[model samples]
Target: MRFLRAAAQALGGGLFLTLFVVFILQVTARFGFNKPLPWTDEAAVVLYVWVILWAAATIVPEREHVVFDLLWNMAPRRVRLGMRIVGNLVVGGLAAVAIPATWDYVHFMQRESTPVLGIPFMWVFLPFVFLMLALVARCAWAVYTALRGQGLEAELHLS
Candidate 1:
């Protein structure tokens, strides 16, 4: 688990670094050289998309996610348990249901390519499919942990 966490962090960090480099190149080329490279702009945008989705899918902890938990904090342990299980089931189930269509749409876009780089659209939007799968897996694990009555402590204050 530690290795997996480290790997996810590394991957996210690498993507962010790549995006930063592309942005710097874009700025430098436009202002310093007075000749903007179109590919840098597209690369930066694509990398930005990948970095954000990758972090959300693999790096962000569940506790760090935004939540409206006033009722959860006030609820009894039993109710909280029910809420956790039900909430996870609903989220995980929806993600699972959407996977087929997501895959289909992503696959369908393989015919299209980015204007500057000529990279396939499927490659660009592929992280969304990864995010969807991650959601389903993460929520399923949360549901399992909630069933075991673990990791369900109510926060005293929102972070």
Candidate 2:
């Protein structure tokens, strides 16, 4: 599991690094050389989308996610557990329900290519499908842990 997590982080980092390099090239080409590369703009956008979705899905920890924790913090243990279960179920159920349609749409986009670079749209949007799957898996795991009478601890204040 640790190796898997490290690998996931590395993947996100690589995507981000690529995005940054593309951005630098775009800036340099447009200002330094006075000749902008249209392909760089498209590449940067694609990389930016991939990096955000990839990090959210695989690299970011669950505790790092933004949450409305005030009500959770004030709730009793049982209520908190119920809330966790219900919340996870709602999220996971929706993701699960949307998977087929999302897959279909992504698959259908294979024929369409980006305007500048001509990269297939399917490749660009594939990370969104991964994001949805990750959400379903993560929520399911949360629900399972809650059912097992675990993971109902109070949120810790960072400050």
Candidate 3:
């Protein structure tokens, strides 16, 4: 779990930093040199997508996502437990369904390349695939812990 979280953080942070540097370079090239790289915009967009996806995948695990738990708090203990299981299963199913479809879509685009960089679309879709896999794992873990009467916070080693 620690390794996976670290990997996500590393990948997301690296991509974000790359995006920033690329933007600065883009600006320098366009305004300073008056020669904007056609490939820069697409590259920046790709990097941004990766950063966002990886970062977003950590929300549930980190408990950083905004939650208005008043409704949850109002629920009876048993009902609350049921809700967590149901919610995790539902979300896990969604992620499971998305995986194959995303794979197919990215595969279909394998023959296609970006106009400027000639980078395969499959390469760009890699981060989305990682994100979907992470979601599936995270949701499954959520369901497992909830079913065992142990919440995610416990698994995460929180007090």
lDDT of 2 at 112: 99
lDDT score of residue 67 within candidate 1? 91
Off by over 4 Å in 3: 58-62, 152-159
| Model 2 pairs whose backbones collide | none
Model 1, residue 128: distance off in Å is 0.9
Candidate 1 ranges with C-alpha deviation above 4 Å: none
For the record, the alpha-carbon RMSD of candidate 2 to the native fold, in angstroms, is 1.2
Tens digits of per-residue lDDT, candidate 3, 3-122, equal: 976876777778889999999999999999999998789999888877777677763343676665656767776877888889889988999998999999988889999888988988
Candidate 1 collision pairs: none
Compose the digit string of candidate 1's lDDT tens values, residues 77-99. 99999999999999999999999
Candidate 2 lDDT over 85-159, as tens digits, reads: 999999899999999999999999999999988999999999999999999999999999999999998886563
Error of 3 at 56 (Å): 2.2
